[model samples]
Target: MTSNDAVLVLVVVTALGFDFTNGFHDTGNAMATSIVTGALPPRVAVAISAVLNLGGAFLSTAVAATIASGLVDSQDVTLTVVIAGLTGSILWNLTTWFFGIPSSSSHALIGGVVGATMAAAGSSAVKWQGLVSKVIVPAALSPFIAGSVAAIGTYLVYRLTRGVSEGPRGHGFRIGQVGSASMVSLAHGANDAQKTMGVITLALIANGTLESGAQAPTWVIVSCAVAIALGTYLGGWRVIRALGKGLMEIESPQGMASESASAAVILCSTNFGYSLSTTHVATGSILGAGVGKKGAVVRWHVARRMVAAWLLTLPAAALVGALAYWTAHGIGGTEGVVVIFVLLVLASVAFFAASRRAAVTPANVNAEWTGSVLPAPESKEATSWTPGST
Candidate 1:
């Protein structure tokens, strides 16, 4: 391969590599509740998530344009800037994963790019109007929206199941949880997976290989979808652990409600070209579900921590991106690519190894959650995740 082609390949590969991390890193967004409440096995959930995520990639390419060459000035962007931005985001992702914090991968990526672009070019490199409308507003609103819907759904679940037997109710809720969880998985693939597609496609367009405003190539979409799917299969046990059992006690009914609520908001947002945070959705749903239940205690401390992480995610990644931009600018493209590749590999490997200490598998996925505390289910459970509930 020619040197330029080789470097281009590396850029695409790194973009996909970030996609892979995005998948596994955010796998908890879809499966945490289901796994916690015994609605789906971790492995089964990831498998379903993988398939649906690829399927979701086919939904639209509008959001991709927002990330690529739109929100940021493509004329000011370079493959090096993209690479540096991706690396910064990846580092932030790995850092949060190790600590089991479910931060916004979407914002992290955007922050990285914004920082890198500003450092490399100037503030004018970012489209402030687009940024405020597309990303900032969504990031601020999505979690609260998801949480409110989940809270209402959870309350409605209890009210609906009031006449059911405890044992039969739990069983029925388990069944219902299955369906709701599956919908979240599918919805997650549709929304979160597309972000990576947009990033890589953006890189291609920025480099002048693909014309601006072109759709992501089928190969790009398929490869990113598959990479993320594989990452989902690998799972993000730490984040799952944090989401399912750390912040709240996820009963089957609560799990079902939260997943359904998240599914609804995420799907609608994605279709409208809004890249909302899956972490925001899932966490808000879980918290809302918890609040909906009578006597359900939300450790305000835990909630506070998550909120802190959310507040810091963008700025942290931005700082990293700025640093990455400065470092790589001195090295130029070829060497910069090498440096980024090594850092991502090392970070990924270290995080993987560290996660082995408390491995969360399909068999033990629900082990951390409370088993007998939830209310019984009423009738047939539906397998769906709607903007609020299907």
Candidate 2:
């Protein structure tokens, strides 16, 4: 009924919009390995990732608690500020996705909130020390940590099974990869879903619907969980192409170990309330797997592009956040938010429709990766493609 109410509604909607983008953008993290390794079909891979992510959403709230309460001064924030920040994040997400860049949606949201808050209430509104100590350092280093661990695990797997016959060794590792990939899927759900829950919680605080320090509500958790789950099912086909195809070709066991290692690290961090980048973790794991395997090709140029994306993620989202906040301010508050929201809707529909022109479905998912309709079957150690099966 009032301007405040309108802004609150807009903020909630925008936060959820960010959640959807988070789902697809981050989908590559959970399922790329499994899909590439023939551990699961593309569609089945997504379906599994979605369900497990939903289940993981219920497992913990420590990470969500950090985002909702730790980063910014919740007491000084406004629904308008939150809305503008989310707008920045959503726009940045689309920009990155359009180019098929796998950026960190979590950092994008944080940077958005910080930039908007600073723009709205000045620098005094932020707690930079806390932000850097909690988010930045871990985000910068965790990937390397996870990557090295994955490389070690991958190498060990091969060394330990060196004496086994090729047939039995391949079969055993294929089975192992399924479980490891599942662990990664579960870990992804734990981290990414909590991010949306945190945003919604922040919106509630900004709106005064909840106490400044209140915990995330059941409704917030469920709504975010379901939204993220649906997005995961849809998958971000672009990043999927890059991740499943571009990095080392993940075989059954190697993909499994990489995903599993990343999953364990992520879950441990979530429990500790640190929101590290899933993109960084997943990307690093894939790279590590590349290093562990013999003659594994690491495309330095493509990887350099991804590394560039990682570096830019926070600052780019922050710049967008500042701009969104100022734009909303210039347009006179709630009406400006409405304008942005309308644009977001139009942009989203157009993008999705355009994507449909040559939609990447499950059947077509691995096709581009292996240069064939089916990555049918072959000897595990066989490097070159079979003429008929890809």
Candidate 3:
């Protein structure tokens, strides 16, 4: 293969890698409530999400067009820029996953690509207006919109069910939670998987393989869908722990409300071609569920930390992206990209090794949260709760 072909191959691979991280990182977005509320077992929740995510990927390509052309000046994007951007995004995903923080993978990818483009061709290369209107504005407003919807839903659910006995109410809500969570999973697939397809399309455009305005190819769509689905099947147990148990102790009713709110917001945003963060919407819904329920406690400290991470996500990933761009540019040619890719792999391995030290898995995913991501040591007397149990 020619040098440009080689670079394009690497770019496609890197884009798929980013999609994989996006999948696992945000699996908690779709299934955390279902798993925690006992609506679905931990493993089962992720399995269902994986199938829906695959299906959702084919549902739309509008968001992919926005990523490929709207956000950055396609004339200025290069194979190097796409590589650096994916590198930045993947690193940020791993960092947040390790700490069990639910940061925005969408922002990380956008920030990385934008940062690399700016570094290579200056701020003029980015479509600042599009960034603000399509990405930033939605990022700011979606959470509030979703939170309000969830709060109202939660209130209505509780009010309507006030007359039901505890046993029947919990069981009914658990069934509803499964359906609601499934919609969120499908919405997530429609929204998040398109992002990687967009990046791959961007790389293709940058390489002159496709016209600047070309849509993502069938191969791109299928590959992205499969990659994300596989990643979802693996699950991000640490993030699941945080969202399911950290934000609040989610009940079946609250879980259904939160998921319904998230699914609605995500589907609407996807239809409008906005690449909003599923993490932000889901987190907001969960917080709103806490507020709407009587005597429920929202862990303000944890929520604050997640919010702080959200605020930092764009700039932080951008800085890394800028640095990666500079490093690759300094080295020049295919060697530069390969060297950076090697370093990224090494960093990923290190993070994985570190995570194994305090591994979170399905077995302990629902262990009582003792104020941290890692569940406290299980006691013999600790009772395991499942769906429909008192």
Worst 10 residues of 1 by lDDT: 381-390
Clashing pairs for predicted structure model 2, backbone only: none
Q: For residues 10-105, what per-residue lDDT tens digits would candidate 1 score against the true structure?
A: 778878888888888888888887877777777787788878777777777767767875588888888778878888888888888777788888
Model 3 stretches with alpha carbons more than 4 Å out:
369-390
- Report how far residue 97 has shifted in candidate 2, in Å: 1.8
Write the number of the candidate with greater TM-score, choosing between 2 and 3.
3
Find the candidate with the highest TM-score and give its number.
3
Candidate 2 residue 110 Cα shift, in angstroms, is 1.1
Q: TM-scores across all candidates? A: 0.91, 0.92, 0.95
Instruction: Give the alpha carbon lDDT tens digit for every residue of 224-309 in model 2.
Output: 88888888888887777677776656776678778877998899888888887888898888888778877778776777878888
Instruction: Indicate which candidate wins on lDDT.
Output: 3
lDDT of candidate model 1 versus the reference:
0.79
For 245-308, candidate 3 gives per-residue lDDT tens digits of 7777888999999999999999999999999999999999999999899899998888888889
For candidate 3, the TM-score is 0.95
